[model samples]
Target chain A: MANHTSTQASFENQTTWAGGRSPFNVSYGKLMMWIFLLSDAFTFSTLLVQYGTQRFSNVVTPITTKWPDPASIFNHFPFMHGLHLPLLFVSVMTFILILSSVTMVLAVEAGHRKSKSEVARYMIYTIIGGIAFLSCQAWEWYTFIHEGARLDGNTFGITKQGYDHLHSVGFGDHFEWADGDRTFGPVPFAALFFIVTGFHGFHVFSGVVINVVVYIMTVRGVFERRGHYEMIEKAGLYWHFVDLVWVFVFTFFYLI
Target chain B: MEFYNKPGDYDAINYIPHTESHGTKELWKTFWLLLGITVLDFVIYFVMPASGWRNFIFIFFGLVKAYYIVGAFMHLKHEKINLALVILVPMVFVLGLISGLLYEGSALEVMKSM
Candidate 1:
């Protein structure tokens, strides 16, 4: 009888300990996510700083005629009328990303409840949101490329008058009219923009792929078997990191 | 089957109450505050006249939004204060670097115009 009583007590103690334990005792996946976010933040900050430096150095040029404006550069849509939309696509992308982050949080919450169905639903939403954002980015890139905004060129296909109008407006006001003859050679600015933003977009794409795989396993009840939503929480960290990077991008690329 | 009915069976069972899973009203309150900051940023950017005051307003709103993003979204507020400081100090350095570079670049531009 004493042996049985001791075993019962031990079981109770074990259950209590496990129940009361904090999520912090989980593995290093979430911690590593945070570190990755910090390093990625630094990479974006450096790129933006460089952009700012270049912009400031060129500020003395006549704002009306010489500056390249981001609004004009990114204004095209294939099916829409030739409306000079400013940051519309980017705004949509931003909203999609933010919504994805929200879905990610919901997924995390579902994970906490061990609600596999809820987790799968939210994860699907998150993936959809990510895909939507990527599609918008691709469209934006297509427009940019179609408009002849090459990395090496004297005239990025923007007329001097258009360039002036763009400069008078706002951020992305430092781009210049590529020389008309296409003889002025490649401008390094376009390359830099592509590199930085492309790298970020690549991160987003990879994140979406990872979440999709996780979602599949979620549907198969893998995490349910593990008896915890730690994976959801880790994925939440990644989603939030992507959103955080966009906050900086919006500031440096748009608002500033 | 033996392990399933082990003495510590309940310990292996994870049960998270729905109430604990869905953050309480406190989280909503924080979300509202962040939205308010975002609105303030937009207002400052669009409504304010271009001047030193406008610039100040923009910077202030930006910092506020950044603070909330770091504190609330990143859960820095729940961390040890020293951890917050460690993370924030490097950000401060980056900001300083930005300002210095902009200043030097602008100065050079001015000199070139002369």
Candidate 2:
């Protein structure tokens, strides 16, 4: 008993970050993944900050407002062509992402249990969610481009008359921009929209690919031979990070 | 200490800490919370006119959603304190950067007007 107590005391006295164990108590891959995510967060934050700066710099004046209200521009829903449906489509996109995030976490949880089949199942659900989101973004981009928004230019500069017309229409009302209601707006508006969402869509696309690869690995019993499923956990971290970034993109881009 | 000093035997590459299933109760709870907040965001977007307060609310909700996603989904809540701080502390500076640049942006607006 005395020796056991002494051993316990020495263990308690040992430094937490001794060279043997991970200071973070996580595996090397997971720790590196966290660091990578921190850097990626900075990337996304810088983009958002640039967005905010561009928007605030183009404040509405008595003459012309450069920044267009997202609602006035992104107020279309699939199958509801002319009706004003601000936030509806993006809301669906958000739901899909959140659902996918949940499924990814579920896969991680199953991985912890070494439940191979369940992990694969949740991974499939997550991949489907990602594909769905990508399709939605494609439709949205097509619509925006079809509406004449371009990388080098923006046609969404709402005139005073356009503002008034937009205000007169209620949610779900049939609304279209009348002539003279729009002018060439700030170039960064469309450009940043494409850049930010395009960057995020690319992340989602890669996330889908990663999920597919991990799914294949799981099916091949690689993890079973390795005696762990931490790969799913690592992929889950990336997946959740994507969802986290979307929360902000949804906030700054659409809702605000 | 001497036993630990042999780095070659440590196998850092494969040293995954043991993990266990903590069940899906909390995860599902977090999902509901995120979904409900999103719904609330939608409702408030339509209900409240665009204003500073509305923007503040949206940002606040965004942060809350971010918290749940990172904490529950990423399992940061169960991570070591050092790990959590290392990951989260730098974000405080990000908030500072956002505010500072926003102020600068407004100043630029004034300059453009001038």
Candidate 3:
């Protein structure tokens, strides 16, 4: 009985705060990646919190003080010009991000199985998805800028008549902003839109770059020689984090 | 218990936990779940009239999407509880910040009216 107790005590001691192994059971690199992601999350949350505060402070009055309705401003669909397709384009963008996130995870899983070609293939798919999302964002920014939305000012605030007109138009119907409909509204409206989404877009761009580098490394049999594909797992964590941020962005920016 | 007398003998930087393929089935399921929730969000946006209730629903769905992404896609669910807590617990403060500022924001609106 004394031998059994001693053996169990030593086992417990080995697992707790041991100098040789990580107490968290994660590698050094992966733990750093998670910590970096946590810091990034704080950054994004601060931005979003500022956005919510600014929006709430500008109470929706009859005309000038009202925050612009996102659906009215973001109703454009690519190749379907002059049609008021509210929420459709952004939905497509969301779908692209979600799809790419899946591909990234698939690549990580394939790496676990030591399937070189499969990891490469999935990484390529993920890179394509990131590029596609970036393109969609480019078009969106262009359309917004073209509509007189600037970083310092916004002309998308719908007047009472404008709000009525916007409500009258059905989905996919031809619509244009009449002269009396728009007035200069809250400045932070356009500013926050650009800042938050642009930040996310930059992340997608970097994620694409990282994915390409990883793809090249995989092709060169670097991981095979190292006997582990842990790099893919690290990159996968960043990719999925970007997706997680978008879910909140979609909710607060467009859906709300 | 044996201890490494030299730091070079224990390379912590090169240490990685052994990983295994849990199959693509769970990953694909999570993808579909995320997709379905998004579709539902789109549908509700069109079907329901805008109200506090609608906004609440949207926020709820967003949380659900976030859970699946972090839990399944990021593999946090399979990680040790200690790691998960370390990553997630700080987010509570963010939530608190959001709620506090939103209230303060509404109060600012009242002040502006004055």
Task: Tell me the tens digit of each residue's lDDT in model 2 across A1-256.
Answer: 3365555455445687555457777888899989999999999999999998998898777766668889678999999999988889999999999999999999999999999999999999999999999999999999999999999989999888887888899989999889988998999999999999999999999999999999999999887777788889999999999999999999999987
- Clashing residue pairs in candidate 3 are none
Candidate 3 colliding pairs, count: 0
Give lDDT tens digits, candidate 3, residues A10-46.
5446754766567778888898999999999999999
lDDT of 3 at A153: 92
What is the C-alpha lDDT profile of model 1 across A10-92, one tens digit per residue? 64465423644223332345555666776777787788678667655655244232324444556554465455555555655
When only chain A is evaluated, what TM-score does every model earn? 0.78, 0.93, 0.94
lDDT of 1 at B49: 46
TM-score of chain B of each: 0.65, 0.86, 0.84
Task: Kindly give the stretch of ten consecutive residues in candidate 3 chain A with the minimal lDDT sum.
Answer: A1-10
- What tens-digit string does per-residue lDDT give for candidate 1 at B1-114? 333222223322332212236462444455566556555655554455444465445455556666665665555676556546656788788878876775686776687679
